[model samples]
Target: MKTELDYLAELAGHGRISRRAFLGRAAALGVSAAMMPALAGKAFAQTAVKGGIIKAGLQGGESTNSLDPALNLSQVTFSFGKLWGEYL
Candidate 1:
């Protein structure tokens, strides 16, 4: 059985609740303000996912896009150039 504190902690971990709100609710539930940090830490702990392909759809791209950094006029070209170390 899950307690209210556990529910609040899970909500905080998943970003469903703000830090301030979580702290407030925990306090209302008689949790010590000082202990809030430790509880909050547990609530916020997360394991990073190992691998996945991330995709984003950005507007402002054109068929006439140029690879040259200097000629980058659209957001897509600019982002692509920056990611491939073109700006460096």
Candidate 2:
């Protein structure tokens, strides 16, 4: 017997949906997640800025920012988030 949740899942069409549909469902949950940061962000107290600042010396690579986080040395590739930051 299919549970109510199962029926809902089927209505989403045989358990397969387009990226747009998946994103729609995700967007609903995303709104709540997004709101929590916006609404509750102020309830938490703020701390004073510490004196230290981080400085990375860019001896190599272009100054341009690449959205591909997985960029590596000597080849072109599709990149997504990874264990290490981007490289040449």
Candidate 3:
């Protein structure tokens, strides 16, 4: 079920409500003033990406570190393996 905040968020997300109106309604619903901006920003943010390649660089890996989990030694290698490896 949707609450007042959820409805407000939806309205804010879809640009159906102005920021001032959203904040006013949210304030009436007892939301903190400090949290209003964050809530509004989250609602206004773009949707997540459907699919994409993710690239990352870590500094702790060494030439001797193996990508194999069983042979992993450094934290960077473990993190790299976790990023590329799939598990059930």
Candidate 4:
């Protein structure tokens, strides 16, 4: 199915899954091996840059706003700050 092909392509595109794995899955799904390269290219083209700041411009924050775990003021800030911390 196209969806399965797309999923495999996406994993390969992000380098989370190997090309061999993608091809194997694709074949098992009845996709032709000759189509692998095109699928790979499409997947790679849609991939985002590997690393960068994930910015969330949360309004209503003041200079007093703190990212400290003990001082998280709101759920949005807490979730965003948690994610940003993980990106480091």
Clashes of each: 0, 0, 0, 0
User: Is 1 or 3 the stronger prediction by lDDT?
Assistant: 3
Local distance difference test, per candidate?
0.77, 0.40, 0.78, 0.75
Worst 10 residues of 3 by lDDT: 43-52
Stretches of candidate 1 above 4 Å error?
A: 42-88
Candidate 2 structure quality by residue, lDDT tens digits, 21-66:
5335545544443443342233333465545443444444454546
Which order, best to worst by lDDT?
Answer: 3, 1, 4, 2
Q: Using TM-score, rank the candidates from best to worst.
A: 4, 1, 3, 2
Highest TM-score model number:
4
Which tens-of-lDDT digit does each residue in 9-82 have in candidate 4? Answer: 77887889876787788888887778778888855444345677577776666677677778887776687678
Better of 1 and 4 by lDDT: 1
Candidate 3 runs further than 4 Å off: 42-88
What TM-scores do the predictions have?
0.44, 0.24, 0.43, 0.45
Model 1 lDDT per residue over 31-86, tens place: 98887787767666657665555364768778888779899877798887776553
Q: Is candidate 2 or candidate 4 better by TM-score?
A: 4
Winning model by lDDT: 3
TM-score of 3: 0.43
